[model samples]
Structure formats: structure tokens, C-alpha cells
Target chain A: MKILVVDDEADIQPLFLQHFRKELRHHDFEFDFALSGEEALEYLKGNSLEVVLILSDINMPGMSGIDLLSKIRQDYNYLSPVVMMITAYGDEENYKQAMEKGADDFLTKPLDFNLLKEKLKKVMNNG
Target chain B: MNFDYILLLIVFSYLRRALQSKILLPKIDKYLAIGFWFSIVLLIAGFFLKFTKEINAWIAHAMLFTLIYFCLTQKEFKSVKSFIYSILPFVVVNFIEDCIELINSPFHDEWNNYFDTAIFFSIVWFFAMFFITRKQRKEMEKEQLKAIEFEKEFQQSEILKAKLETQVAERTAEILGQKEKLQKALDKLKTTQVQLIQSEKMASLGELTAGIAHEIQNPLNFVNNFSEVSSELLDEMNEEIVKGDFEEVKNIAIDLKKNLEKINFHGKRADSIVKGMLQHSRIGNNVKEPTNINKLADEYLRLAYHGFRAKDKSFNADLVTDFDENLPKINVLTQEIGRVLLNLFTNAFYATHQKQKKSGETYKPMVSVKTELKGKGIEITVKDNGIGIPEAIKDKIMQPFFTTKPTGEGTGLGLSLSYDIIVKAHGGTITIDSRENDYTVFTIFLPTE
Candidate 1:
């Protein structure tokens, strides 16, 4: 399975890679990274079929996670990948908006890698 | 002869008493009394000795003339008109008596009846003179009573005037005391105002606390994650070393080293954020220190944005910063200048947020901060693409207690206090340029010296 992780913080890339190093090394999962929602969208446009899941942070500079989610749902409805939103604030409003906009799951920082791996396995099995 | 002397005595005594009481000339009064006594002695001698009638009459006339002289010489009667009116009666009477005696000597039996008539007329004239002197005395007494009343009224008025002056003095002292009390109260109020301003600075810091937490959280998250990864990498390295895979062990070692570096980097990031927060909230002595303007502006810009974001999670803006790299450090009150920058950045974010709410998705909120090295000074510019300040309120924005924010949402002292910090405290100049519904730019210029 291939996953795209989008966050404005550049360090998230390395952290995610290190946490999933076994899966990445075993060829069980492949990872792509984008620094922002805009970059995520650009990545999805070029390589939408290869990515099976999208993990994105909600707070970003140019385009937000919700905006990106809605845009992806509207533009790529036929190739809809599972989209999960990550946020520092786990407030009801953001959760409601993300759910309403078709988010498959929600996560809050600091991310628990064990739980995240379990969720990723579930998604892999479902897909 | 004795009767004639007695009659003259009676007339002289009456005149003396009347003049003595009214004119009040002590010397004249003594003389008049002595003359009266002398006249009495003359009468006694006339009775004792067998004097001729003519001689007796002559002696009586001499005594009468002496008394009249005394009365006429009195100050009250010294005027010719008064003397003629009062003493002329006695003089005419004496003249008539002398003429009658002289006529009787020529025709004794025939003039005897005329002599008696003349004596009766002289007696009437003396009575008239006595009455006139009594009326004059009464008039003088009335004048003296009026003068005494006038003196009494004058003395009472003087007492009243003195009382009024004293009252006025007391009232003046009282007013001065009240003024001094008011001045003291005003000074106390001024000190209270200074304390309130310090609290306001703390309040702004309180507003930034949520943002500061978020800022620190990001780095903290990285620190935790990186350390955990490094520990895992160590475990992997240990396993690889046991498996005798030197290449993989070296790779794990490199990864571990990178993770450690990241942890250090993120730790320092968190430390700087905390240090900035401390500097902002510090109640320093307004001491000027060499400071980098760009770093100050950039730190505050991020802080204000994050602070705004923490409050309204949906709100976001494009933060653009243009800092002069070669700019020299200038002396400034660091905390004060930081506050000024925070205030400006916060206002910019607020303005853009408000415009976003109104204009919806069509409006992109943008706040840009720029610092430049101008000649002899530095300039800082904060620009916002939002609902700009209206022309009518542009001039009032920097005045204390002037605000566009809703009640309880703002204390309205942000810009005013910033103005004080930038302009008065640091000898800087702040100016605003804005167009309603378009944009706003706040520029501050601080001298290097």
C-alpha cells in the first residue's frame, strides 16, 4: 500500500519514515510526503492511482486540510482514497467539519505510532 | 439802692448759669461766677453802708457791664451777629436805666414814674435774654446728641468690616487646603494609571499564552518523537551488530545521530520560544539594549498569528516577512519594542480576520511585516490586506480608549500604548496609511543614535 502524509512541519516527514521503517524496509508499505495541503493536492493530481490513503494536517498556510479534503472528494470522486485528518486541536467543530467533508478518520498530536499502525493495517485490509 | 444791686445780681447769675452750661468755656464760666459773687458783696455793702443812690446805680452798672463782657467774649457768642442778638438786650437795658437816672436828677418827682417804667422794661429785656440763651443751649445739646449717634454708627461699621475681612481670610485658607487635597488625589490617580498600564501589558501576555503553548507543543512533539525514534534506532543497531551486518549497523547509527540532532534542534526551538515569552512578559526597567529589529518583528508576527489562530481555529492568514539581513543592532527598550510589534501584528491579524468573516472565501487574509535599514535609522512596516481604517477614525485610532472592537473585546489602549512606546519612550515615529475596505500599512521609524 502507498500513503501520502501532508503537514506543514518538515520534521513530520522524517518522523513518519522512522516510525514505519520496518514496513518501508519490507516493501509492505510505501510513503510519499508533501509539506502542505497544496503540495498534497499537486501530488494527488499526478499520482492519484498509486496512493491508497491520505493523512493530512488540518492547519496549513495556503490551503487547509478540510479544503483539500473537499476538493479531493469533488475532483477525484471515482478514485476516492481514504482521507484522515491530523490536528493539534481535537475540537468538536474541526471534527464535525472533517467528518461532514468525508474524512475516514481523525488523529491528534503527538501521534501514537502503534495506534496509527493498527489503523493503517485496518485500512489496508479494508481496501 | 440795695434793691437795684439785688436786681443786677439776679440778672447776672442767670446769664452766667445759662452761658456756663451751653458754651462750656471753663475760663469764662469761672470769671462769670466770680463776677456774680462780687456783685453779691456789692449788694451786701450797699445794705451795710449808707451809699447815695447815684453811686449805687453807677456801681451796679459797672458790675453788669463786666458780666456782659464775659458773656460776649464766649466762643459761641464771639460772632458779631450772635453777640448783638444776645448781649445787646442787656446793654440796651443798662443804657435805658442810666438815662432814666440822669433824667430823674434833672426832674426828680416827674421822672420818678418814668424811672419805674424803665426798670420794668429792663427786667423784661433780661428775661428775654435768659430765654434766648436757654433755647441756644437746647439746640447745642441736640447737635451733640446727633454727633454721638453718628460716632456710634461709625464704630459699629468698623467692627462689621473687620469681621468680614477675617471671614474672607478664613475662606481663602479653606479653598487653598481643598486645592492641595485635589492635587494629591490627582497624583495618586496618576500612579494608579501607571499600575493599570503595567497590568495591561500583562494582560496582552496572557492573551499570547495559548499561542505560546501551541508553539512550544510543536517543538515538544518533535523532541519526543525524535528521541523515541533514536531509541528505536539504537535497538535496531544493537540487533544489526549482533547479526554482524556492519553496513546496516552504520546506517542505523547515522539515523540515530540525525534523530539526536533533530531532538537538539527542536529542544532549542522550544527554549527560544520560552525565552521570547519571558522577555515579553518581563517587567523590566525600560532599559535600552542592542537588539535585532528583524528578529523582534518576526517573532512577534508569528506569535500574534498563532495567538489569533488559537482563539479562532478556522482563521488563517498568509504571513509574509521581509527582513533586512545586513541591518545593524540598534539600542532600544527590547520589551517595549516587542510589545509595540505585537500590538501592530495583532491588529493586522484582527483586521484581516474581520474582513475574512465579512467577505468569506473570496478574501485571502494577508499580513506582511517588513524591516529596512534607512539612512540614520531603521523602518518597520506592517501591512494588512483587510478592512482598512475608515478615514474619519484614522486620526483617532492612536488616541487612548479609541477602538473599533466591540465592548469587552478590547481595552482600546493597544495602539495608544504602542504609540507611547515607539514615539515617546524610544523617540520613534509611527504613521498609518489606510484605505477603507482595501488595506492598511503601519510604519515605524526609529533613529539609530
Candidate 2:
């Protein structure tokens, strides 16, 4: 399975890779990273079929996570990648908006790697 | 003649008493009293011992001379118009006596009785004249007494008026001194009031702590995540070393080192943010230092944006900045200029936020900051596409305690304090350009030398 992780924080790339080192080593999952929602869209446009999962941060300058989510759901709906929103704020409004915009799951920071692995396994089994 | 002389002695005594009482002529009064008593004694002696006509006439003439001498010796009596009248009776009696004596010598027995009756009638008429003159003198003396009393009263009143004027002058000087003291106190109070308002402005900046906390969270998140990742990478490195795979261990070690560097970077980022906040909250030392205007403008702009974001999570606006790279560092009180920038940015954000709420999705709230190197100085402008300031209140925006915001929502001292900081403290100029419901631009010029 291939995954796309989108966040404004550049450190998120190394942190994600380290957390999923075993899966990356075994070639069980292939990961790509983008620093912003705009870069995420550009990545999706090039490799929409290869990416099965999209994990995106909600808060970002220029384009927000909700905007990205709605764009993906509207523009690339047929590709049908499982979208999960990650945010510092786990407020009910953000959760409801994410759910309404076709988010498959929600995650709050600081992210629990164990739970994230379990969710990824579930998505792998479902896919 | 003897009756007339006795009457003249009585009238002279009465005149002396009147002069003493009304005009206070003690010396003349004593002389008149002595002459009157002596004449009485002489006349009584003549009546008892039968003194001859020659001796009797000599005593009467001597008494008349004494009375005239007393009256003439007093300067007060000499000035009176009534003095002549007082002496006329004595003169007439003496003249009539001489005439009768002369006529009797020519026809001694035949005309003696007729001449005696004529002398007696002449004495009666002069006596009446003397009484009338005495009454007139008394009235004139009473008028003179009234004039003296009036003169004394006028002198006393003049002294009292002088005393009152002096007191008034003293009181006026005292009042002027008090007025000066009050004016100084008022000036001191005004300065203290300005300081209090300045502190109040700082207190409002304290509200930015919430936004700072939010800002700190981002770097803190990275620090936590990177540390966790580094720990996991260390565990993997140990496992690879146990497997005798030196290449994989080196790779893990490199990853760990990168993670540590990231942790350090993020930690320092958080530190700088905290330091910036502390600098803003602390009171300024009012010392001028060479500072990069661009960096100051950018830092405050972010602070204001994040501060607003922390309050209204739904609010977001495009923050556009065009800082001049070639601009020279200018001398300014860092905290004071920072405060001015923060105020302008915060106000811009507020205006846009308000317009966003009212105009909804159609309004794209935008705040832009630009710095340029104008002639002899640096020019900074903060422009906002928000609900612009109304034309009527444009000039009043920089007045202390003047606000268009709802009560309690704003301190209203933001622009006023900014105005003071830029114009008064730093010797800069701040100007505003705004149009209702369109846009607002605040331009500041700080000279460099």
C-alpha cells in the first residue's frame, strides 16, 4: 500500500518514516510526503492511482485541510483514496466538518504511533 | 459808665467760656477770667468806700483795656470777623463817657441830669448790640467745631483705606502663588495619567499570551515527535548492531542525529518566540538602538495575526508583506516601535475580521505591510482591505480614549499610544488614509541619521 502524508511541518516527514520503519523496510507500505495542501494536490495529480491513503494536517497557511479535503472529494472522487485528517485541535466542529467532507478517520496530535499503525492495518485489510 | 463797665466784664467772661469750650483757647480764657474778677472787686470797693469819680473812671478804663488785650493776643480770636464786634461796645461806652464829661464842663449844673440820661440810654443800646454779637459768635464757633470733626474723620478713613489696599495686594500675591502651585500639580497629574494609559496599553498586549501559547505549541509538537522518533531510531540502531549490520547501524545513527538537530532547531524556535513575547510585555527602557525595521514589522505582524487567530479560531486573512532588503537599520526605541507596529497590525486584523463577519464569504480579508527606503528616512505602511474608518471619525482616531468599538471591547488607546510612540518619542510622523467600507492605510516615516 502507498500513503501520502501532508503537513506544513517538514519534521513530520522523518518522524513518519521512523515510526513506520519496519513497514517501509519490508516494502509493505510505500510513503510519499508533501509540505503543504498545494503540494499534496500536485502529488495526487501525478500519482493518484499509486496512493491508497492520504493523511493531512488541518491547519496550514494558504490552503487549509478542509479546503484540500473538499477539493479531493470533488475533483478526484473517482480515484477514491481513503482520507484521514490530522489536527492539533480535535474540536467537534473540525471533526464534524472533516466527516461531512468524506474523511475516513480523524487523528489528533501528538500522534500515537501504535494507534496509527492499527488504523493503517485496518485500512490495508479493507483495501 | 460804671453799670456799663460791669456788664462789659460779665459779657467778656461769657465770651472767654464760649471760646474755651468751642475753640479750646486756654491761655486767653485764664486772662479773661482774671480781668473780670479784678474789675468786679474794683467796682465793689468803689461802691462801698465811695471812691471819687476820677478813680472810678480809671478802674473801668483799665478793665476795658485788659479785656481788649486778651482778645487781641489770641491768634484764633484775631482771625474771627466777630472779634471787632466784641470790642465795639467797649469803644462806644468810652467815647460817650468822654463826650458827657466834656459837655458838663461847659454847663455844669444846667445839663448834668440830661447828659446822665443820654449816657444811660447809650449804654443800654450798646449792651443790646454786644449780646447780639455774642450769639452770632457762638453759632460761628459751632460751625467751626463741626468742620474740625469732619477733617479728623476724613483722616481716619484715609488711613483705613490705605490698610485695606495693602491687605488686598498681599492677598493677590498669595492667590497668584497658589495658582502657580495648582498649575504645576495639574501638569504632574497629566504626565502620570499618560504613564498609566501606557501601562494599560501594555496590559492589553498581555492578552497576546494566548496566541503565543498557540505559537509555542507548533514547535513543541515537533520537539515531542522528533524526540520520540529519535528514541525509536536508537532502538533500531541497537538491533541492527546486534545483527552485525554496521551499514544499517550507521544509517540509523545518521537518522537519529538528524532528528536531534530538528529537536534542537524546534526548541530554539520556541525559545525565540517566548523571548519575543517577553520583550513585548516588558516595559521599554526608552533607549534608541539601530534595528532592522523589516524584521520588527514581520515579527509583530505574525504576533498580531496569531493573537487574533487564538481568539477567533474561524478567522483567517492573507498576510502580505513586502519588506525592503536595501533599507538601512534605523535608530529607534525597539520596544516602542514594536508596540507601534503591533498596534497597527492588530487594528488591521480587527478591521478585516469585523468586515469578514458582516460581509461573509464574498469578502477576502487582506492585510498588507510594506517597508520602503524613502528619501532621508524609512517609510512603513500597514494597509488593510477591511471596513474602512468613517470619514467623520478619521481625525479623532488618534485621540486618547476615543473609540468606535463597542464599550469594553477596546481600550481605544491603541492608535493614540502608537501616535505618541511614533511621533512624540521617536520624532517620526504617522498618517492615515482611509475610505469608508473600502480600505485603510497607515503610513509611518522615521528619519535615519
Candidate 3:
């Protein structure tokens, strides 16, 4: 199974890689990285790639995470994929907006990787 | 014949009275009265002296001249001409008698004929005096009538002058009263304007808060989360050590070290956020004072609407203020908060104006401000019926420099700065609710304490 991560912050890459090292080694789960919402859309265009789960950051320079989530839902959510939004601040306003835009789930930074793992395990089981 | 002393005495007595009348009237303290009596006695002694007939006749003429002079002093006789006319009959009779005496060889012979001629002259003198006195009385009557007319005119003028003075005083007082009322109204207007300007300055703080929160909160989260996870990892390491898993312990040690590095990085990020927030807030430095929140909001609402009108002449809006009269006075930096209100009102006006342009004459641009007493504090809302923010960019609205307005019109830092003022400085919250084509409402909550 392949999980896609979209974020503007370069540091998030290393953090996630270290956090999911065990899962990457033991389970047959592959990870892909996209710097922005536009970049993620480009990667999704490939006919061979099967992106099952998408993790996106809400705030960015262009094509914010919320916009990316809406576009994914409108175009490809029926293809057995789940999208979860990440907000910098755990404000209820942003949380509600993400949910209204068809986000499956949302979390705040610095992300609790343990909780995220538990949720992902559920996604992995369903997929 | 007669000794003629009796006639001489009678004539002299009459002369003495006329001369006495020529002397000035005696003052109340008559110091010279004794001297006058003594002179009278000398005149009587001269009558007994047995002097020559010529001497007696000369003395008698002197007395007659003195009598004429006395008659001149009478109040009825004014100028020298009138005096001469008054004594003319007496003087003429005396002159005729003197001529007769000269013809009779001396004044002594004329004395024998004096009684009959004197009686004839006395009749003439009485007639002249009667006419002169009658004329004088007529002149006096005319003078009295003129004095009465002058008194009446003077009284009328005095009454007119008094009336005009009172009227002038009443008019002056009326003008002063009007001036005082006008000054009071002007003072009220100026105070309202000042409060509005203060709120305008604070509006920028909200946008600054949004930027600062996003930048710092994300890193702070990382620090907190990594620290908590590291502690949990230590317990896992303890469990592994009990099993004598040496390799697993080494991996856990490496993971803990990496977590500490991230904690350090995010900790520094949080520190910088605090520094930046302080720096930004300092720019809005103002001393707090007891403030009426309702008055502040209402004033800014009017000022903003007028400000928009000044920029675009065609722009107009129905501005409304619904203030809670029961709200208590709160301690606040009046100018800073006034600035925030000004910014919000200005944005509201701008939104309404833009909508008016799109919707034409049928659309009425409306902007309203409301202040209400809330839990231990106050709440203010600015609402506008105009162009609402699009949903896609709603989350970005509070971020610094994110504006839908064209360049030169909006810096887009207004909402962000207002957010900073309310949340960071005042321990308050700012929220927004909007529909795409309907309305935009910004609600602010402030704590009293």
C-alpha cells in the first residue's frame, strides 16, 4: 500500500521518515512525498501509481491543503483513497472547515504519530 | 410858609430806600449791617446841620442819582438801556426842575415851586413803571412755558434711552446662550471622532496575531509532542533492557537523541515566536484607561462610513449602531481598541461600497455595529451587507497580507492586527461568519478583568 504526504515544510519529510521507519521495514507500505498541492496533483496523474491514503498540510504558499483535499475528493475519492488534513493550530474553526470540505480526519502539529498510526492501521485494514 | 424840613425829610427818606435797594442783598450772616445803620444816621444828622441852601440842594441831587442807580439794580431792569428807560421819567422831571431853578436865579427859588411840579412828575413816573412791569411779567410768562416744554422733551428721551439699553442686553444674552449650545455640540463631535481614530490604529493588530500564532504554534506543538513521545520511548527502553535486548536498547537510545534535537529546534522556534509577538505588540503601545465600549464602537462606525464617503463620493451606506446601555465601563487602551474598531468599520464600509457598485441603485449598502454585555466582559460585532469572503480563501483571511482588495487599497493586515490585539494583548477572541453573496459579520469577545 502507498501513502502520499503533501506539505510545504521541507523538515516534515525527515520527521515522518524517522517516525515510520519500523512500519516501512516490516510492513509492505511505501511512502511518496509532494511539496505542494500542485505537486501532489501531478503525481496522482500517473496511471501506474496507486495512492491509497493522502496526508496533507493545510497552510502553504500556493494551492493550500484544503483546496487540495477538495480537488482530490471531487476527482478521485471514490477510487478507494482517504485524505486527512493537518493544521498548524488546533483551532476548532479550521477543524470544522476541513471536515466540511470532505476531509476524512484531521490532526494538529506536532503530530502524535502514535495516534496517527492507530488511525492508519484502521485505514490499512479497510483498504 | 413852611420850614420845608418835613418835605425835605420825606424826599430824602424816599431817596435812601432806593439807594439801599442798589446795595447787594445781605447774606444770612450780615457782618456789614451795623456800618449801613451808621451811614443812615450820618444822612439824618446832615438834615439838622443848617447848611447853606446850595449845599442842601447838591446833597439832594446826589441822593437822587443814588436812587436811580438803585432802581437799575432791581431784578426787573436787565440791560443799561432798560435801566435808563425805567428811571427816565424821574430823571427828566429833575432836569426840568433844575433848568427852572437856573432861570429863577438859583435852586432855592425852585424849592418853593417843587411840591406842585413834583406831584405832576410823580404821576408820569407811575405810568412808565406800570408799563415796564407789565412787559416784564409777560416776558417771564413766556420763559416759564418754554422751560416746561424742554422738561417734557428731556423726560421722553431718557425713557427711550432706557428702553433701548434693556433691549440690547436681552439680545446679547440670547446670542451668548446660542453660542454655548453650539460649543457643546462641537465638543461632543470632536470626542467621538477622536475615539474612532484610536480604534482605526488597533485594527492592524489582529492580522499580526494570526501570523504570529501560525508561525509559533506549529513549532511549539512539535516540541510538546516530541517531548511526550520521548518519555514514552524511555519506558519502552526500560522494558527492552529487562529482556537483555542490547541491540534494541541502542536503537531506542539513538531515537531518543534525535527526538531531543527536534525538541531543541522547536523550542527555539517557540522562543522566537514569543519575541516576535512582543515586538509587534510594542508597536501598539498605549496606556489603558476606563473606557465605554459601546461609545467606542458607535463612533468608529460613523467615522468609517464618512471616511468611505470622503474617498468615493458616490458611496453611501445606512450605518446603524445597537449599543448595550447596561454594559459597565471596562479598562482598555482606548486608542488601540478604537483603532481596531475603525479598521473593522472601514473594511465593512468598503465591502458595502463594492457591493453597491455591483448591485446598482436597487441595492442599499448597510453597515451596522453592535456592542453587548457578555459573560464578565463585552462583545462587539461589525456586520455588512456586501461582498462576502469566498469560502476557499476564508481560512486565509486572517493571515498577514492576505487580501482580496486590489493593491493600494488594502494591505490586508487589518484583520490580522486586530486578531493580535484581541487575542494576544487583551485575552479575547475574534471570529467571523460569512456567506458568499450575502453578508460578513466579525464578532469580538473581550474580558472585563
Candidate 4:
């Protein structure tokens, strides 16, 4: 399975990479990264990667995770990749909006890698 | 007339001077001056040897002039009686001189008898004048004293009245000052009331959000778990079918039945999350109860951190807990304090997170929560290794709507509400200590009883 992780923060990339390095080594999967929702959308276009899961942070500077999720649900229905949202905010309104935009999962920070793994595994297996 | 008579007149002057110096003393000097002038004129007239009767008449006239001068020099001139008293001594001297002349006369005739009668009539007039002058002087002195007493009384009353008025004015000013202070306090109270209402509204909203999230997450977790298990079973079935293992495929179908039973398990979880939300939104509920502090603190801290983790996959913070095991249970509204703790922890994480971003430093940011039992009170300290609060803003941080966080980054009511909860509601104290570029500690002391 191929997963695309979208977040605007450069520091978050390293943090995520540090936590998932062992998992990356063990799993028969590849993870792609995008610094913005626009970049994630652009990467999806003309790309031959068989991406099965999407993990994105909600509070991006441009094009939030919810917007990307809605776009994917509306425009890329054929792909049908499972979408998981990450956010620094844990407010219910955001959770509701994300679910309404077709997000398969929602997580608030400081994210526990174990929980994230369980969620990702479950989402990918289901997808 | 005689030495005794002269002694008696001098005694009268002395007594009058002692009783009323203002009435008697004015004529004293003038009488002495006239007496010396009349004695010199009497000796000179005798040496010249004028008609014996004529010389005696001259002496009488001189003596009368001296008496008239004494009368003019007297303090009181109220009536003719005062004038007669002034001349009474001169009249006695003249009658004695006339009796001596009558006894020594060369011819013993009726002329002597006429002289004696004239002297008798003068003595009667002098006595009448003397009594009238004494009455008039006494009246004048009494009236003068009465006027003086009335004037002194009027002056004293005026002074007392002025003093009383001044005291009243001072008291009035003091009352006005107190009224102004009370007015200012009332204004402050009104402002605080408005702020309290606004904070309560926000707190209610936070409670609703937390409940809704809990409800949604429960069912969501089960759906996620069940779906993964089903997908795994399907994958296993597909794998066995590809390997042409008919027995393995049949076995997988049986396993699928057990996974189906778990489907309702996840459904029930989703239902509970929904139920929690409904309960949270309901108003006027009796939710307050005596809660175990150590247990609640641990559970709520876990929930708060995990709740945040449920959103951002990459967000992480180092948290340390040192709860006192022996601390007594506290009575509180559990949900409200839980929300407060969540807010503090979230803010601590963000503050450190922002610093880490700015410094580009790889150091681990630590947030430590510690509880201790001290006497009848429990102290909870939350310390964070974040960009410490500035000295200038330390006092203002607990003020409502005061924040250094960027807009949308914070609601700016966390510390303020936390302060109110601990101080006003729980009868506790919350104090903050911070060192710039080092760390910040928030200490809360709540009574056990």
C-alpha cells in the first residue's frame, strides 16, 4: 500500500519520520509526503502510484485537510482511498466538518504513534 | 471740722475704690490737688487781716471751689445728687469754721444767731446730696457690669457655633468621599458581572464539544476495529482461493462469523458516544459530586492528551505525572475541572511547540504535573518547559481576555477561567511562577475539608 502524508510544517515531517521509521522498515509499503494540500493534489495527478491511504493534517496554511478530503471525495471517487485527518485542534465542530467532508478518521495532536498505527492499519485493511 | 471727720472721709474713698475702681478712683487725684490750693489761700487770707467775717467767707468760698472741682473730676455725673456727695466734706468744714467765728465775735448780737442758722441750712442740703450721689454711682456700676457679661457670653457662643459648623463640614466631606468610593466599587462589580456571564457561556460550549467528541469517537472506534477485522478475513479468503486451498477458504468463512458478532460491539460504542453528547448538552443537570482527586486527575489527563492525539497523527509532547497517592478526595464539578486541566495541558504543549518551531531546536519539551498533600490542603503543580511568560505580563495573564497567543491560536480565557474556578468557586489559590527562557509553573492549592 502507498500512503500520502500532507502537512505544511517541515518539523512535523521529521517527527513523523522518526516515529514511523521502524514501521516503514518492517511494512511492505511506501509513504509519500506533501507539504501542502495543493502539493498532495498535484502529486496525485499524472502519478502512477497505487496510493491506498491518505493522512493529512487539518490546519494547513493553504488548502486544509478537510478541503482536500472533500475534493477527493467529490472528484476522485473512483480512487476511493481512505482519508485520515490530523489536527492540533480537537474541537467537535472540526470533527463534524471533517466527517462530513468524507474523512474516514480524525486525530488530534500530540498524536500517539501506537494509536496512529492501529488506526492506519485498520483504515488501510478496510479500504 | 475735726480730725476724726477727715479720717472718716478718707476711709469712705478707700472703701469705694475697693468696691468699684471704675466708679470711685477718677476724682481721688483732683480732690487732693484742690485741698492743697484751698489751705494755702486760707493761710494767706488770715495774714492779710480782712474783715473777720469776710475772711471766713473767703475761706468758705475757696473750699467750695475745691469741692466743685472734685465733683467735675468724678467718674459718674448721672444726677445732681452725685455733685452733692462730691461737696459734702467741704460743707462740714465751713459749719465748724462759722461756729468758731460766732464764739470769738467782738459784739454779742443777733448777727451771730443768723450766722448759725445759715450754717444749719447748708449742712441739711449737703447730707441730702451725699445720699443721692451714692445711689446714682451704684446704679451706673451695676449697668456697666451687666453689659460686659452679656458681651462676653455672645462672643463665646459665636466661637462655639463656628466650631460646630466646621466639624459638621468635615464629616460631610468624609461621607462624600466614602460615597465616591462605593460608587466606584459598584461600577467595578457591574463590569465583572458581565465578564462572568460571557465566560459561563464559553464554558458551556466547551462542555458540549467535549461530550459530542466522546460520543462520536466510541462508535467510530468500534466501526474501525470491526471493519479492519472483516477486511483481514476477506484478504485471507482471497489469498487461500488464489493458492487453490479449498479447506482454508472454508475455514475463513467460519472465522468471519465471529468477526460479525463484534460488529454490534462497535455499534454499542458508537451509541454510547452519542448518548454522552446528549447528556452533556442537557441543561440544569445535577452533575456535581465528591470525586477522587488522584483517580480523576490521572484519568482526565489521559483522556485530554489522547483526545488531542486523536486528531493530529504527528503531534507529540513529553508529559510527566507525579500524583500524590495519599491525597484526600475533593468535592468538585468533575467535568468542569477536567476541561480546565485539558486547556492548561493543551496550552503548555502549544507554547513549547511554538518555541521549538522558532528555535529550530530538537530538545524534547516536557510538561510535568505533580500533586502533593500538605496539612489539610492539596497542592497541584503543573510545570512546562516552554517559552516562559514575560515578567511584564505575568500579573495580567489571569485577567479576562488577556493573551499573547496569536488570534485563533487561543481563546485567552483558559487561565482566567481556571483562576476563577480555583479561587472563587473552590476557595482555593492559584499562583504562577515563571522564569524567562526557562520554565513556567502553575500551582493550585485546594483545601481537603
Model 2, B1-449: lDDT tens digits are 46645755665666676566335867666766776777677677767766455676666766656556655675666643354455555555565566556567656446667656665665565667667766876787888888988988998999999999999999999999999999999999999886877676566676577677767888898899888878888888889999999999998888888888999999998998988877776765767899999999988888888787767665767789999999999999888888888888888999998898899866878999999999999999999999999989988999988988899778888888889888888788999999888899999999896
TM-score versus the correct structure, for each prediction: 0.76, 0.80, 0.47, 0.46
Q: Using TM-score as the measure, what is the rank order of every candidate, best first? A: 2, 1, 3, 4
The digit string of per-residue lDDT tens for model 4 on B13-111 reads 433444353455456545544554555455455457555536546555545545454445644432333554545554655655555666765543436
RMSD of 4: 14.2
Give the C-alpha lDDT of model 3.
0.70
Model 2 agreement with the true structure over A8-126: per-residue lDDT tens digits? 88878888889999999998888899887889999888899899999999877656788789999998889898999998777788898899999999999888888999999999998
Give, for candidate 3 chain B, the lowest lDDT window spanning 10 residues.
B1-10
Worst 10 residues of 1 chain A by lDDT: A59-68
Q: Report the lDDT tens digits of candidate 3 across residue range A1-127.
A: 7889998776576566666766876765678899988899989989224888899988654466877888888888668478899976567767887899888999988788889989988999887
Residues B182-264, candidate 3, lDDT per residue (tens digit)? Answer: 89989988886555433434434453345445566667767776777677778878988999998988988998898899889
- The CAPRI class of candidate 1 is medium
Model 3 CAPRI rating:
incorrect
Task: Give per-model CA RMSD.
Answer: 6.5, 5.4, 15.6, 14.2
Chain B superposition TM-score per model: 0.71, 0.75, 0.38, 0.49
Q: Rate the local accuracy (lDDT) of all candidates.
A: 0.84, 0.81, 0.70, 0.65
- TM-score of structure candidate 4: 0.46
Candidate maximizing TM-score = 2
